[model samples]
Structure formats: C-alpha cells, structure tokens
Target: MADRRSAGSRSIAIVGPYLSGKTTLLESLLSVTGATTRKGSIKEHNTIGDASAEARDRQMTVEVNSATVEYEGLRWNFLDCPGSIELAQETYNALIGVDAVVVVCEPVVDRVLNLSPLFNFLDEWEIPHLIFLNKMDRADVDFMQVLHALAAVSSRPLIPHQYPIGHGHKLKGFIDLVTEDAFQYHSGACADPIPFPEELQVEEKSARQEMLETLADFDDKLLEELLEDIPPPQDEILQDLKMELGADLIVPVFFGVAEEDYGVRPLMEALLREAPDPSATAERRGLNDADNQPIAQVLKTYYTPQGGKLSLVRVWQGQIEDGMTLNDVRVGGMYRLMGQQHQSVLRAGAGELVALARMDQVKTGDVLTAHAPAPDLPVARMIPQVYAKAIEADNRKDEVKLTSVLGKLLEEDPGLRWEQQGDTHEIVLWGQGDIHLQVALSRLQRKYNLPMTTHQPKIPYRESIRRTTSVHGRYKHQTGGHGQFGDVFLDIQPRERGAGFQFTQKIVGGVVPKQYIPGVEAGVRDYLARGPMGFPVVDIAVTLTNGSYHSVDSSEQAFKQAARIAMQEGMPRCKPVLLEPILNIKIAVPNDFTSKILRLVSGRRGQILGYDAKAAWSGWDEVVAQLPQAEMHDLIVELRSLTLGVGSFEWTYDHLQEVPERFTTQVLQAAWNTK
Candidate 1:
C-alpha cells in the first residue's frame, strides 16, 4: 500500500510560531507513519527535528531540519523550520521549494495574531497550506471561538475538517466532518472509528453543515445538491475538499494533541489525499518542462564538520544522479537527511528533497540545472537587519580563520552580515535580533571552534573647529653637512557645517616654492587624521598665506614639517566640537503603536522628520527620524517588544550633527579610553 502511494515523492514544510509544538508534532507524525518505533519528546531533548546541539542547548529550532519517511508506500519529506520570528527567514527559504506548508499553532485565541506575518507571506506567494491546531488538550477556549479567531487573521476561508468531541483541556476525540463518524484516539496508535455521541449530535451536524457550505462555494454541483436538500456522497465531499485545498480556496483546520499522537494519522491521510502533486506544484512555480535537463533549487545549506558542504535541494524536473554535473559543478553524493543523520541515495527523482554533498558553490535559493541554463526561480526577499554588534576573535592568531568561518556562516544564513567599518575599524555583525546573533556566535564556537567577543559598535564621530586663529610655523635643524630651515604662516578658519576640509595657498614673491606647496597640504591632512578631540577632523579650511624656505636645505619634507608645526600652533586656538553620526531610519509599525514608537525615538535623542502611512501597507505607519547610531544597537529590541514582534526598520547614514554640550565631556572621555 505504501509503495502504491510512493509512485512519486512530495515535500512539505512544517512552520509556526515559537513554542507552538511544531517539533513535537513532527515526532508524532513520524511515529504514526511507522518511520520510528517510538516518539521523542522535546523536554527529553530527544526529538528528531531539533537535532542540532545548539538547538538542544537552547531548546528551540535554530535551523531548517528535514526528515524523510515512507507511509503506506508513499515517500514524504517534511522540512521542519524554526519558529522564532528571528529565524523566520529559514522557514521562508524552505517554503519556496515545498509543495505545501503545515502551519502549526497553539489553540490560544490571542496568540493567533502571531501567525499574521506567516499567513501574509503564504497568501502573497499563493503557497498552499493548512492549519494544525496543536496542544488541543491544553486549550482553554471553545473550538468554535478558536476557529473564528484564526479566520480573522487569514485571508482565505477556514473550513473545519473535524469537530472536537470534548471541550477545553479534556479533549477526548474528534468527529470527522466529511465521513460523519466519530473517532477515539488510543494511547500510541491510530484513532479507532466509533459512533457519534447522541448528546453532541446537534453540534456535529452544525459543524458538518458549515464545512459543506464552505466547500460548496467552490463547487457548483455541491452547492446545488445542498440547496436541493440532497445529501452529498462521502466520496464527492472528499473530492471537493481535495480540489479546494489544492486550489488554495480554503484552509482546512484539523485539531490534535501532538504529544499524544492523536489526529496525526488523519492529517497524514489528508495530506496524501488533498495536497497537490509535485507536477502541479512545479507548474505553479513555472518549471513546466519536465523533459528538460535536471533542475533543482537550494532550500538550505549546511557546512558539516565531517561531510563538508551539503546543499539541501528540491528536485523540480528531470532526475539527479551521482556523477552528474550541475551548472559545471560535479555532484559528489546525494543523501536523504533524517535530522542530522543522513542516508546515502544513488539518485533523486523529480520532487525529492535531498542533500547534495560538496556543492560548495550552491547557496540557499540558488537554482541548479544542467549546462543548458537555469530558470529564474522565485526567491524570497531579504528582511532588513535591525540589530548589530562589533565582533572579533578572542585570539588574534585566528583572525583569518574567523573571516573564513564568517563567510560560511553567511552562506548558510544570509540574514547574518559582517563588514569592517572604514572609519571606526570595527567589524560589525548585523542580524535580525539579539538571539539571532547569539545563534551565529554559538555556531562559530561549536562548528568552527572559534571563540568570539562582541560589543556595541563604536560610532564614527567627527571633530570640527568652531573658531579660528593664525600663527607662524618654523622648522630648523642643524646637522653636520647643512642646516634645515623652513618657515610658514598659516591662516586657519572654520568652514560651514558639511563643507569639507579645503586647503589653499597665497604665498607669492618666491616666499614658498610651488613645488613644495603640495607637501603642506599633505601635512595638514595627516594632522586632521587625529584632532584635539581624538577624531578625524572635518569642516575646516587652512591657507598658507606666507612662508619662507631655503633653496638647498629646505625640501618638501622640511616644508611638510613646518606646515605641521603651523597647524599644531593654529588648531589649538580654534575651538573644536565633536560631531556624532546620525542615521536616517524609517520605522514601520502598526498605527496602534505609533505613539509608543514616537516616545521611544524622542527618548533616544532622535529628531522626528515626519510620518505617514507606509505605502501599500494598510494600518501601518512609517516613522522617519534621524537617530544617532549609538542608540540604534538596541532600538529593534524595544520596537519589537512594543509592537508585538511586528515592528521593523531600515536605515542609512544621514549626516553628522554636533553632540550636545552636556554629552561632550563623556563622549570625549570614552573616545580617549578606547584609544
């Protein structure tokens, strides 16, 4: 029976919010499918999905995990994705290659809002998905109420496929709406069919009618039969459910306590019956030519300590076999990933998700095909980073290794970024949040054995003169052969803000030779590298109005020394000010959180430019503000906390502004200490 269903393989992703029992549900699915003899629990740190040491240490999934199973002869590959919003990009990347997504969620009503972003992405991309209301035994609300709450957040119709027989935490079983039959769950076995309870008959009938009405909206025959008071056949109803689900006309909601393995078998059956086949999914993704060369896409990339680079890919067309070359890169080996464990496979046919080892050049979301040419696969857009920190290796000897590891880390997770800031000379690592960076650091220590230290990045501050004065500079040295002598009078003046440094000379009557004039400019620039405030100087002008130089003894080097002397005497007379970097940040949040965001910006010494409705995003406001880079390190943390983890921002360097008088002392002290 399983072999009959295994005619073709299919891949699906399990996605949801954190602590939603997604991994627990995966264990149940594997157990019920007979892929494993016993189910693993998360509390015991024995689950198959969250198999990585980092995940086990944190008790959360930090990366995408894939497990393959054969149920009733059907080959099924499930991609279990991380649930934290900080790690949502992993789920999004895996989603692009799957035939469908099983959205797991808690039965809590208020928390249903947490699924808004995931649902929005699924709808926007037209990805087929279903809802699995997990932890039913712990739910405190009515099933109908939960359904309504879920419907409010989804853009499609919610069709209840089963109605729970019991209420609240004592959920005993559920009645399948299509078959009109009650089924009671066993401790660790498939549910047994049973007769409907007499007391709940009315409620069951009503739920069944609602399900039919939803399905009828998508089926004319079903609607006519219902309107004429003709009961639809069970097979006919099942067919409609399958067709509607594949078309993404409705989201079929199923209930279960995954820890107890209840409802998992039924959900698997639904997947086999209703989920679209790989051919249909491929056509939907625009990979319609099945006879073409092998085509695939990378869903995730892993750098295994033992196996090296493994590219988790979904085969979209043709077939992939060992010894074949894809995009000019040789295929070393293909294996099916069972958590961190792998099973070698000779070949992967169309629609199978397998890992191709040693494909170092393939990155997540890249398309792989034969020499003919790869199609432009649909890729998920990158989310802008909101948090960052300066990081460095604890041991200086490992600096080169640190860079190589950072490249691998970024290839596995594009959301992690690092760059060396030119001004501050700090290597900053940017990510979605604090935890995201922590995970990367953990990976660095665990996978590459590189320990790191992190801190808030230093702001690239500038120093400028507020007042000016003129002074004479002279250089004289007596040596054995000759004496070096050069003299210069410099006029220093403050330039307008944002008007960069300017150098000019007015020496005439052979006072200073033109050939030596360039040396004075270089000397002034060299001095500007470190100003009185211990920062690069800007917004000042220096002129060599008068200078004397010897024909033989005075050279460019002597004139340069003289110009440096003149600046040393003249700059102290010019009062210098410290300037802080200001970033133009656009913060997007729901309108309800606008006031709180405004207060946050104000509290951080930010200047509000203006605010308006974000383009094309209803009920959200974009607050434009100029905030000092010093305050931005933790801004995303606070913004998400105030906006229910939905707030985000994108920023760019705007300009430098004068540091307030009150902060000048502390800023200067900090700068001195760092130096």
Candidate 2:
C-alpha cells in the first residue's frame, strides 16, 4: 500500500453517464471509510447524494453533492456530480477543482460511447482520471471486450491495473497486475488473500505484460527492463504509475460492482497509491504556492432553505478562517458538507473543499481571494442552452419576484439562462433540455413559493408586403365646436429582403406642416407593429407624399389618426406575406451517425449547407444547415437520440425567410389559435 499521509487533503469527483452507478460508488466509498455508519440506498431515497427534493422525486442527481470523509488519516472530499448529459455543466464546473476523478461507468459495450464527451473534456484539461467499470457482477459480456469498447472512446491509452478473477455474477475476486496477487471478496468486509488460480495464469500474464508495456512507453528504464526480459521491481512500477497518472499520461482501468461493495476497497487503495495530491493539482492549475495568500474558486453554489446562500469552494492556497474577508465580502460561516448536512468548522486549509455560508456576492466559477488581485482561475465554459420555454407567473403579482428568484437560480446553476424576449414580449427561460427547465421551475415553486406556467416559446415572426400601394385618408370628426380635420397621402412599398423598416416624408410645398409630419411617421410605425398577417411588419418603407392640415383642427394627433386609417386600408390590399426566423446551425456528431443526422435535418425542413470533419475531434463531423426557428423546439431532443447523446449543435440567428406558401395557412391558423 502507498502512504497518502503526506498528500494532505484531496478532492475527487464521481462522474459518469446517467444510471451508471456513480452515486452508488460514492455511497460505498463513504461507508468503507467509516464516514457513515451504513450505506444509503438510492431506491430508498436515503442516499447522501441526490438528497434534494427534486432529485429524490426524480431519483436522479439534479445537482452536485459534496461530502468529506477521513480515509487512513487523510481527509478526502468527494463530489458526486449529476450524470445526465443535460446537467453536464455541473460536472464540468466541479471537475476543474478536484485533484483527481473516478469515472464510474457500466460494463456494457454499446453504452460506452456515452463516455466520449466526458473523456474528451478530461483529456483536453489534462485532468488525471481513472475508470471504474461498475456492475461487473451483472455484466454479461467478456471483460476484455468491455475494455476494448472503453478504449475506443478515450483518447488516452488505457492500462488495466487489475484482472477479474471470474465472469458475470460469479465474479468473486481480482488479480492485481502489479503485485501478481489474488484476493477473494467478502460481503461488507475486506478482501482476503487467495491462491492465484492456475486456470487464469495465461490471461493474467498477458494483461500484466500489456500494463507494463504502456507504463514503459513513458519510462526509459522500464522500457530497458522490458526489452532485457528482466522483471522491474514492484516499487519502480508503483512509482511509474503514480507519476504517469498524475501527469495524465495514461488511464488506469479497474472493475467491480459498486452496489455490492465488491472492488470498492481496491478502488480506494488504487486512488491512495496512484492519484495526484493537491500540490500536484495546484501546480497544474498554475497556482504559486509561495504566495500563501488565501485564494479559492467557487465550484458550485447553493441557496439553502435556512442558510440563505452557500458557496462550495476548493481552497487552492492558504488557509481560510471563519469570517475571513474574501473579495471584500466576509464569509459568514465555513462548513464541511456531508450531503445536505453541514458540519460547522472554524477553519479550512488548502486543498479542502468546504462551503462558505452567506457568500451571496460570490457566484459559481468566481475566483475569490483575500489579497488585492490575482490571475483569475479558469472556469468551465457554460454549455449552450438547447431548450427554451416561455414562462409567466401564475399569480401575476409574483412577476417581479419571479425575476429576482431566477437570478439566484442562474447564479446557483450557470447552465440556466433567462431573458425577456424583445420580439415576442415574453419571459423565456432556457436550459440544456426539458428536464433541466422542469427542475428549475420546480425550484421556483418549491423554494420561493412562486408557481409558474410554461409553454413552448413563441417564435418571432414578421410580415412584409409583396407589392406597392398608394392610399389616401381623411379624418374629420365634428364632435365639438372646432371640427378635427386632417388629410394625408402615403406610399407603401416592399424593400429588398433584410432591408428592414424605413419611414421618410416626401411632403413638399408645406402642404403637411412639419409639426404634424412626425405624427404621420409615428402612426406608420405603429401600424407596422402588427401587420395584416397578425405579425410585426419588416422589410418595407413608407413615405408621407402629400397631406393637408387645418390650422385649428389638423393637429399632430389628427394627422396620426389620418395616417393610421391610410395604413389600415392600404396594407391588406398590398398582399402581406409571413416571414419566419431562420437560424444558421452547426451540428456536431460522430461520423458514424452523419447519414442519420442528414436525414433528420432534411425532415425538419432544414437546408444542408455542407459537412466537414470537425477540427481536433477525430471521427467526428460538423454539419452546417439553415433551419427555421419553428422547427427547432425539439431538435436537440431528437439529435441526441440519434447520436447516443454525444451530438451537439451551435446556432445563431440568420435571416428571416418567407414562410413557404404551402405551409403559410397552417402557420397563420396556429398563430390565430394561440390568440
């Protein structure tokens, strides 16, 4: 066993695809380390992770959960991150602060591709990580086949550190490749040493040799020993493993059933022996240890029911005492978190993951320090929102409160975004997917006592004319002693597409007074707000050609009413057409699914521009297209389904295009029905 006492406090993240047993692995780790008296089951809704009501109701991790434990005299902080691809931003944010990561996944080969995005992220950041193939006892495939599947997705080379001793549910033990020792697992107890099975000698030898060869790739001495057929000393092998792992040169693979705690102890042992310590992680993050001034980065933020606000932070350098000031804000309290439980602590040292209470000014991804100013630490880039819903307060009186509450929600989860749509005049909430928005809405209701009604966001549609029309109008109201009299002549014409709206006065001879001319232009704009098609009009120009105004009755208000009458009669005769927003989109997916994506795009009435191999991403292609906004509501949902959840897209507003004549009636009917 390798000693981790000198490493000080360490933080690790449990991350994997949805339903991959990451939470279960976390429960096992806490149990084996004596942090908890017994393991809590996920089905029973008693697990330390996923303790939030939203998570328990859905039986999935909706946010990041933090817990601290003492294993062999070393404090270990574990962050159990949400596994849903939609909530991946939570995992990415937490991963940047951790010293190491344990990527928990199932042994199924087909589902292994779900790990590709995660693997790419980890490798790109050079964050040292290892794989724990969970549910081995239930896996029906060969262990080697599963290993090969996992290797296909990861960019880094994988070396098996342990070989399984049995297949499927009969899995009872594992042979340590480095030590060449076999041990049998006992329920809820430490593994006992067992004689190396002779039947597995050949397979174990191959796996062990393969592991050595990979390690040799980075070690000249190890290479020489392999070339000379001399067995390298065990200590030399362990040191090489630790060095390469810390540098992120290789990914060591291990397997076990986390639910039964079968391989949990060995996994923890490997972490102790091979995982990088905080100092190594800090160096990698470009922190100067000599500066000793307290600096920390917020990994996640929580708005607790009682505490008001809690910022989960990783202390990168120096110690943080309770009530210490950071970034001009005093920390109200400091605590170590175990799920939702907070254990008050007076102080926290470097490498410790602790929650600071009442850090309302701090947000997720913010770098805070007591000193003047330091280089800001890099935070995870927020993923683009793929789904959106127009939300409104059910009570109407809570409208202002809803906006305030949403700001706190966005601070807690950067994945969420909200905007007041300028075009549609609606409050829209955007998120990674429907489920993500559902959780946010649930938070609004449960935490803030604000109920909201949500629906698919309305697309911003505009209308324009197909022809020019000249019209005249006169407003003469004789309701008082001085009769209101105003006359105006206007010319309306469609400009080139995307030319937008323009209004100018072509009046001459002072027939229409300059004072009333402004009113005429304002009335033209007001009519354009809602065209004959029941949508905002665009790409048209209106000119005030000629008009007459009475000195007493023809005021600006009279001219405005006259101009409105002209437009109301002329616009319908000019032949109005509906225009829908088009988005320029780039969809990225594995090349294997390129053909399927093409079909999907065409089915959504999208025009494919072209496709090319995505830069820096092997075997992945980027498809460019222009898609109507009306067809984009559920596009991401279908895209992920077709590409095994690895596909993503970037989109920006292109130009408004005329709605095809064939579908114009349908669009108009839908618009009317909504009214």
Which residue pairs in candidate 2 have backbone atoms (N, alpha carbon, C) closer than 3 angstroms, thus clashing?
A: none
Question: TM-scores of all models?
Answer: 0.95, 0.98
Total residue pair clashes for candidate 1: 3
What lDDT tens digits, residue by residue, belong to model 2 across residues 455-547? 999989999999999999888898758788889999999999999999988878999989899889888888888989899999999999998
RMSD of each: 2.3, 1.2
Which candidate comes out best when scored by TM-score?
2
Residue-wise lDDT of candidate 1 within 1-675, one digit each (tens)? 553465488788999998998999899988888889988888898889998888998899999999999876668999999988898788898898888889999889878878877887888778889999988887475789899989987888999899898866677888999887899987678889888888998888999999999899989999999999999999999989878887777899998888888888889899988888788788888877646578999999999989999999999988899878988899999999899899999998888999999897779999998865689989998888778889999999888888788999999998888999987888899999999999999999989989899988888889998897998999999899878887888889999988999999998898999988998888888889988778899999999999888878998888888988888878878988889889999998878889999999999999899999987455679999999987888999999899888788989988888999999999888878877
Per-candidate Cα lDDT values, in order, are: 0.88, 0.91
Against the true structure, candidate 2 has what lDDT? 0.91
Q: What is the C-alpha RMSD, rounded to one decimal, of candidate 2?
A: 1.2
Ten-residue region with minimum lDDT total, candidate 2? 1-10
In every candidate, how many clashes are there? Answer: 3, 0
